[model samples]
Target: MSVWDDLIGQEPLAHTLREAVAAARDRLSGGSGRGMTSAWLVTGPPGSGRSNAARAFAAALQCRDGGCGQCHDCHTALLGTHPNVTLVATDRLSIGVDSVRELVRSAALMPANGRWQVVVVEDADRLTEDSADALLKSLEEPSPRTVWMLCAPTAEDVLVTVRSRCRLLVLRTPSPPAITRMLVDRDGVPEVVAAFAARASQGHIGRARRLAHDEATRNRRREILRIPTSLIELGACMVAAANLHEVAQEEGQGVAATLDAKEVGDLEAIYGASARDGRARGYPGALSTLKKDQSKRRTRVVRDTIDGALIDLLSFYRDVLALQTGARTALVNDEVRADIDSLARRGSADSTLRRMEAVLKCREAIAANAAPLLALESMMLDLRV
Candidate 1:
């Protein structure tokens, strides 16, 4: 087995990265090679496995046998337990300068057990301007034994200067067949369920797996799909918007509940806060700051969930438009073929297109920090069929 094995339908990319790994190994042995580089920028569409590719590369760099997936080095690096590998993935909206500075400090250190100190930033596009500036110096003069791998949606999403300093690797979305095979063979999903998920998720591997395994996730998607049919009048639209918002809030709470408790517990432990001893001095202020951060995180999580639902809703409309136009393409929401056909029949192609535009506008509004309920209400009104 190899680290590249899980990277389905990306053979060309895998081959290129493998060559770079071999070249880096040769350079370590005092033999010059052309493919090796200290910094790499990996870009791809959402769920195209950019971070997976970065992690695989880091594992290959640390592995003596060049990413023999069974080895301890490969395991540790992939699992994020390697002493020489640092994987920085954020749940926050942006990567701050403080975080980048700490990573920069770590990057300056030499490897303890591996050939290179690998630093993988999973969301390079989320770097704030100050954080980007802080990252520039490290990219410009990286330690000889350090390798930086940054992942983002596209090259343009990253700062021009930072992108210019790294080798670029673009990964394509895996095909449905490839995703289906992975779901069945790797995740042990039933073939029929895997096939449906692979089709429905539209090349998003993580979402495909979730759709296959999680009944609640699939149910949420079904509810989103039903929105087009539900928006029959103003009252219905308002109710739909409220329902969508509520679903997103519930999912956001589900996602954050455990993490929030763990974070509170950790903070309490650090400050030695206990009911037996009462609150420690200065504990209130620190707890307040922590709560503020958690509030921001929860807001972001809710917004992200809403954004995903919007995407799914958009896909349904796109399917409607496709049907109206006589397009032969497979529908992303094939599970609701009858409903999509009914929707397409009820609305003209032009109206379907207009509804799609409303969805896009709502996404923009939410992204601009407009009130999500208001934006969703407006979108739902526009979507009234």
Candidate 2:
């Protein structure tokens, strides 16, 4: 399949990018072109395939047949192993200055095996101010053979200086029908399951796929949805809050366990601190630093897990509000329509909106580093019917 095959419901944007790829090929062949740029800023909401678009564009730039996905260049670029392609992605809280400087250094090089030296930054919004400044210099004096693609949630999420120096491409969130079709057709998911996942995920393709394929994910979501109905009293609210926090912690630990083990093993190998060798000279400081970084990463993973659960909770309340208001749009949690109707009948529209506001506030509180249990307790109390 072509690189664009997985980019569901984005034909217009794909066409534009493909045209640019063709024009770049023409320019490389000593022909004039107008649709290409040295730097591009791709903006879309979460799970709207911003990074996918950037990666596809990178592959197209490297492909001899302008992204004939079967070619070696296309495969390597898509996998991020292309000699001329540099992909900067971070799992940390921020992309620091040192990382940006390394990216800038890479951007200065000419293409080794392709017409363009493509650099794709998957989380441009995560760039610290200092790193952004470093990136701005490279954008200002871009190498002729180098191309940069920066992806973020929105243009406003990036610095004005950085956004201004690049061409803008915006992607729309795919509709539920579109997402459903993709899940069923591409992933071979059952139709009923795909529909539920598509509605529940709210246009997040990756989330939809997970909800369709992973029973554990669906169970966690079911637990989250049950929280609203379970918050019948102060004691129950506290219990629900604790349960939610525990679930988030469990999910976070599951995600971090393998990565943490690998990181520890790598550090141990680097410092020769295995069981046989014990600690090498100067290993203590390095080990401490590694642990500190891992701690921060674990904290981030927990917060992210909580944030996702909050989003699911928010969608549940939103469904209740929609039912209360007699809105015509499809419910995000349509699979739980009976429960939603029961909850809607139990509360007024304003109260449901208030619950949503509480969810948002809890999200903000956790983002501000408030204790998760405390923030969730307050939210659950507010959600009580």
Candidate 3:
């Protein structure tokens, strides 16, 4: 295992990154009259490793051997300890104007390592309008040795002005076999567990890895996949909706709570002593910021959890669709084939497809800022009928 292998199911992306690195290196080595551009946009869906591609490219650019994978530059970049590389990863909802201003000021300086100064913004979508505008100016007139890397779900997530000035690299979801092979060969997971996780994650490499490694995650998924067969009555549908919302909340809270505490603790340490005498003028504002961040994180968690559950729910209907049509390809819920057979007998293929459509609508509603509880409840009611 080479370090790049951690980027599972992303061969095309890796190839593109490699090509970019080779070109950048060739330009940097004084072989071309054209100078290397100082900005790049790496865009992809969730869990598509846009940041990973950017980081790998960064490592390759700084590497003496052009990402030889064994050099100090490559190792440090991969481990996120490279001296000239600055990464702004927010646990909060947005990258505020203050932070953006500071990073912009930093971009003007020469590199401490006498190499390229690299700035990677992981959640470019979270940049506030003011921050985005600030970043736009920096990108428009970059310093000689500076490189700006922004990662987001799509190019449209960043301002068109910012995106138009940079090179763009788009990433795609990997195949299930590619993901499974990675889990088994690289992570040392068993083939059976790897296969299950691969199918369950629907091509998300990180989620699949977690599913393979964590029993609790596996159990949660099992609970979700079991909901379809259990929704046999009106009351049962209501109960299932409530259950799904609660579980998603619980899981999201579990992921966010510890980080939230850490952030609050750090904030207190920065502004505590002065506030004790009622002289900390900005204490209230700081507290508000903390609360807002927490709220946003909670919302993000709920959205992610619900999205995963929706996929799980969709798989059950998909299996039914496959069975009804007599297509013998592998089912997502292969372990529950018997239940699928039973459901197929009760529902027509058209009904199954309609349920899938309802699930997709629920996803759109949640994405468009509908309340999670209401959305889930409505989806459940529709599914029950």
> What is candidate 1's local distance difference test score?
0.90
What's the candidate order when arranged by decreasing TM-score?
A: 1, 2, 3
Error of 3 at 154 (Å): 2.8
Off by over 4 Å in 2: 270-286
List lDDT for all candidates, in order.
0.90, 0.88, 0.83
The TM-scores, one per candidate, come to: 0.96, 0.95, 0.90
Query: Which of the predicted structures, 2 or 3, would earn the higher TM-score when compared with the native?
Result: 2
The alpha-carbon lDDT assigned to residue 92 of candidate 1 equals 76
- Which one is best on TM-score? 1
Local accuracy of candidate 2 as per-residue lDDT tens digits, 275-335:
2265477677776766777777888888988898999999999989898999997888877
Least well predicted 10-residue stretch by lDDT in candidate 2: 270-279
Clashes of 2: 0
Residue-level lDDT of model 3, residues 1-385, one tens digit each, is 3446656667776776667666677766666624366888888887777777778777877887767778888888877789888888887777899999999998888987766888999998888888888888789889877889999899998877778877887888877898889888878999999999898787788888889999988888888878778877888888988988998889778877778888767877888787545577887788777888788888888888899889889988998899999997889888888988888999898989989999999999998889988999888888874
Cα-based RMSD of the predictions, in order?
1.7, 1.9, 2.4
Sliding window of 10 residues with minimal summed lDDT for model 1: 271-280
Better of 1 and 2 by lDDT: 1
lDDT of 2 at 107: 88
